[model samples]
Target: MSGMQDRSWWGREARATVALAYPLVLTNLAQALIPATDVVLLGWAGPKVLAAGSLGVNLYNACMIFGVGVMIAASPMMARALGQRAHNVRDVRRTVRQSLWAAVALVIPIWLLLWHSEGILLLFRQEPELAKQASHLIRPMMFGMLPLFVYQVLKSFVSALERPGWAFAAGAFAVFSNAILNYALIFGKFGLPALGLYGAGLGSTISNSVMAVGLAIVVTRHRHFRRYYLFGNFWRPDWARFAQVWRLGLPIAVTLGMEVTIFNAAVFLMGMIGEPELAAHAVAIQIASLCFMVPLGIGQATTVRVGLAYGRHDRVGVGRAGWAAFGVTMVFMVCSASLMLLAPRFLVGLFLDVHTPANAHVIDLAVAFLTVAALFQLVDGAQAVGAGMLRGIHDTAVPMLFAALGYWVIGFGTAILFAFHLGWGGIGVWVGLAAGLAAAAVLMMTRWMRREKLGLI
Candidate 1:
């Protein structure tokens, strides 16, 4: 009877996790499509446009990750509130209100950064013309940053309440809209201006605005959530609640910034090699990142699950939630890695014209990058989910230190040694990334397990 009960409980947990994660996975993929659309449309334009767009996106994301990471605090915070008492509407309302303040505060510096993208790229040693072109693309796209952050905050809000389907629907609609806009604007279709890369930027800006407004309307007007008083006070600031969010969220922002910048730094180093290398790196990284969205969604679901358990002080439930998420992510990533390893040619062909003589070199390098990417998928999935689990427990500060040490101190250092000293080119850089993710995974998982066993949460 005892064993049977344990089995039943595990099954229920797994089902609940899957229920939450499936829609979220699709939503994340849909979110990915915005950029994938840009890559695909811009790829058709030419390698120059593709490379310039990649540079712009890399620079943009390196900064954007911090803001998004900060807003992610809303998930666990709201989850805990609802989990502690399912009808704790005021707490949930407070968290949502405060998160918006943080979002607006975070975007100011990001806007300033985007305004000077040209100077930053030049300082990073990017080619002058490419830097200039990338700055042009990024400047217009900067308008979308606040909206995107707002959407993310709302995404965290709905997701924590276990209402992921609404977010998914909104994101899916945005994806479709973005694709159509990219097609129309990139090539002068549908009587729209052919602004090339700038068109792609404008498409993102418009789609982000749509998503933010759409999600906000859903949250504010939906019958189920209206009870939470989510939009009750339109003009009040709760500095205490805001500080609580920032205290937990700032470390998360720094941790994520460190991780993203590692890759951004890789892009910078690859740029030094040549334009073809940089373009191939961009395509390969984007493809790998798309695959990453699966585990990322699962990780997000785990954050909610673990957070709920933490709020209720259910230690066993917390362990089960984290490990269950870890198991699913590992299985999925293994399959994804297999696809990368076995179908490198088919995968690389998606981003480049493999048949074209001009793209031959790019395709070959991308295949190599994909192979290295395959090796890192497991650790990457582990670390991503592990981080989510820790975040659920409101344990962000130490993990921030861990990520800094792992990604920059160990990961970037290794890349420098392998790529420059050993002369292994871009492949060396990817290998270093794999190493960094492995270290972070070990550290985070170990931390979670120890805390779980000790009943520290």
Candidate 2:
């Protein structure tokens, strides 16, 4: 009877985790699509536009990752409050309100910097033409940043309510709307002017703006979310919670930086190797990124689950939530890893023509990178979910340190040794990525396992 009970409990936890996870997964994938569509539009424009647009996009993404972390803080905060009392209206409302305030504070400085994006690129000694072209793309695209930030806060709000389907609905709408608008604006279709790179930028901005507004409308009008009166006051001060948001959020941003910047760094390293290697890295990274969304979504859902448990002071519930997410993440990672390993060439061909003699060298290198990417899928998922588990318990500082040590010190250091010193080239750089993720996975999961001993519970 005890064995049967254990099995039943695990089954229930697994189902609950997946129930919260699927919609979030689709939402994340939809978020990815907005950018993916931009890439497609740029590719159609030509390689020069594609390259310039990519540079602008990368620069914008760096800031997005950092600033959005502050907004995501509200998720755990609200989740915990809700767990304490299912209808903790005042507290949940304050968190959502402060998250908006935090979003406004975050956007200003980033806007100032992105305004001179071309100059920043030049400061880094990028090609003058590329820098100028990139600025054209960024200037209009930068306007969308605030909308994206606002959208994130709203997303967190809806997600915390466990009504993630609303955000997904908004995101799905953005996907189609962005594609259509970009097509018309970028290519001069349907009586729209062909503004090229500027068109892509403008289209995405409009799409994000509409997405935020649409979601805002739903939250305000929908009977379920309307009771919270999320936007109850246009102006109010919740200084304490506002500071708490930043205090808990900056580490999360830096932790994200450790992972994102390393990959950005690898692009430069590949550039040092050769054009073919650089090209291959881009294709391989995109494939890996798409696969990563599943585990990443699971991690997001895990944060809320674990936070709910943590708020109730239910240690067993916390453990069950965390492990359930980890298990689900592992299962998905394994399937993705197998696919990458078993059919690397076929996957590479999805981006490049396999039969083209001109593409052979780049395709070969991409296949090699995919193989390495497959090797690291499990550790990557482990680290992603582990960070979520820790974040649920309001534990960010130590994990930030772990990320710095592992991703930079251990991970980047090994990449340097293998790629340059040992003459591994592009392949060696991938090895470093694996090493860094592995180190983070081991350290983070270990910390989580010892949560009780460390008084985190």
Candidate 3:
């Protein structure tokens, strides 16, 4: 009986982690696919469109990161609740409903900001043509803001409950719809008007809306979730719970903003060098983002597992979950880095038309940038995993400080010095970034280890 209990518990952790992480990885991949497809399809529209789309997407992405971070607070809280089995069905239903309403509140302002993106871009003094194109892309994509926000809220709830297959199915559906829309709208296939870069934005918006509604339907219909949907009771706002959400989510939101701003600052600095350099930086960032999904997926699992284990006072389980995620992330990073190093040109060529005259310099620069990118993956993976582990312990504030100091003070400062004072150019800036990430990795890992020794994790 003891052996059987041990086996069952082991199976639960393994199955739960894998089930959550697999769908998350797939969803991350699908999210990446949208931009990957955009880069390919927009190539036909010329360099200006590509540049505009890149800038607009980067801007939007930076803003969205804050929302994503805020939403993550929900998962840990929900996971803890599930672990303790403290909440009744009605309570769970109320929490989920309130969360959705909170999401709606958060999304509205962001959508408004997106609508006024043209004014924001004007402040940058970007090339007029590029700004116009960016405005076009931004406008259509704004429609997706609410849907994406709503989906994320639901996703957090599902993942926390260890039901990630539903989220994966939703992501799959969105990807399929996005692909079809991109082909039809970008190229004017099957009698659709060719909207070029605008089409890509529209396609994303439509796909997000579909995914949000579809997932909502599925969740509402499911036996586990149906009990949580108390019509009149669920609709009312609970100020106390909302305040708790805000308290937990706000710091995460701020941390995300700072991190994304640091990256955006880097991108802006890259643009000052020239279009080719900017494009190269974009390529490297994209490749890194793809590699990042592994840590991200594992991180989600870690957060859930840790939260659950902590609530149960299962210290060993928490430690194991954190280590399992870290190990998996490291292995994935190594493989991803290998692929990037081995076929730098091939990877760049997949996005940019290498043979084209306008793209020749961009392709060459991308290949060069990716070489520097390859070395940073190990440190990046380490830092991400360490942060994930920390999050599992509900220790967010210090990690946020670490990120700000490391990325801004060390990373950006080093880049400015190396890029300008030392005449090291783009490679110098990348090296600075590597240094920052490596420092962050070391510091975070040390902190996590100390916390573990204290029995905090």
Candidate 4:
């Protein structure tokens, strides 16, 4: 019965694809809500608070994205193992434990270094008040790093087992929890003292902690996971498995870090332009992020599907998964971009009080950035899906190199020229970013196709 169920789970291409993609899509959307909820709560405080939250969240994302990349390496490895029917529950649990250790090793230095974030913020020469508020928000958020990593590791484990709904549920719970806490804490409601912006950070930290613990509990209780859990020793780390994960994870870590650095550089450049431009960039980034969730989810699905295909030595299945995911992502991106371009003001207004005195200029800038954003979503979606497909093949090194070149050499270089040399401002920076993503999309897809033809995938 177990064998039959496992076979049925991975046998049908379309059904399995949807099963994998839907949960991931929901999970990604829910993850996006964490920051969106923070922004909404802080927006009620005023523009300065919103700006500060934006800055702090961007910094947090910049740090965490690389950690996500490290975690991403696990899903493909696990998926391939499962597909080959060689994966043990004990080994999976061991990997999870080691990943937690890795997360701790990585985050501690980051936390200590960021203790002096005010100095880092000064590099952008941002408003002193905004900088101070951002630091306050950032410090508390850092405490949640370990919990966030644990949540991600569990999510990756669930995704590898082709049971992505568990991750989706965990993320949804976190999102709802965050929203309620933000309301209660931000406004001093339900007899709780209002912590204001600090409360917003606290809400996020608590939500992440809950998510981590909840997922750990649920996964441990699961029949599938029970087969893997050792009854007596839970804390023992497997050095060999840790090394394997690190070998697969390092390239992805560097790739994600480079990609995020390019965007952070763009944010810093926007800050140099002025407060309104920075705020507008923030709004545009949020809108773009919402659109991006679809591709990210599709990419995750592709990774699992492709990895499984590779494990089964089904070259055609790998190719089909890659193409299907890319096509689906493209369609979603087109519709999302069209909607945003058609009604930029209405969308921006949903998050920011456009009618307010402090936000009028920000709205105008956001509209302009949204216009540019519309053109880039297609390429961005394509590249992300392509990267996912490659990850399934365990082809991390070349993809990492491509990402580095695409973002740093091509994307940042073009942005610097446009923003400074050509005097195009934020619009130029966005256009350059679009070009970089386009380059990545074309290169990555071509590489995957070639590899497929050679039976490498």
Task: TM-score for candidate 2, please give it.
Answer: 0.95
Query: Tens-digit lDDT track for model 2 on 1-457?
Result: 9989877877898899899889988988888777677766775565456556666776777777788777888889998998898989899999989888888888899989999988987775656786788788788888888888888888888888888999999989999999999999889999999998888889888988988998999999999899999999858898998899999988988998778878867765775676577667767887887788888889889999999999999998999999989999999999999999999999877666688786788789989999999999999999999999999999998999999998999889999999999999999999999999999999999999999999999
Count of backbone collisions in candidate 3: 1
Candidate 3 residue lDDT tens string, 21-117 = 8888877777677666676677666766677787777778877778777777777777777777854455556556666667777877888888777
Better of 3 and 4 by TM-score: 4
Name the weakest run of 10 consecutive residues (lDDT summed) in model 1: 448-457
lDDT of 4 by residue, 333-394 (tens): 99988998899999998888877887888888889989988998899998888989899998
Model 1 TM-score on a 0 to 1 scale: 0.98
Q: Whose TM-score is greatest here? A: 1
TM-scores, each model vs. reference: 0.98, 0.95, 0.92, 0.93
**What is the overall TM-score of model 3 with all chains considered together?**
0.92
Q: What shift in Å separates residue 75 of candidate 3 from its native position after superposition?
A: 0.2
Model with the higher TM-score, candidate 2 or 4: 2
Task: Go through the candidates in order and give the C-alpha RMSD of each one to the true structure.
Answer: 1.1, 1.9, 2.9, 4.0
Flag regions of model 4 displaced more than 4 Å.
Answer: 1-12, 230-232, 452-455
Model 4 — which ten-residue stretch has the worst lDDT? 225-234
Answer with 1 or 3, whichever has the higher lDDT: 1
Query: Candidate 1: misplaced stretches above 4 Å?
Result: 452-455
Could you say which candidate leads in lDDT?
A: 1
Tens-digit per-residue lDDT, 351-384, candidate 1: 8888999999999999999999999999999989
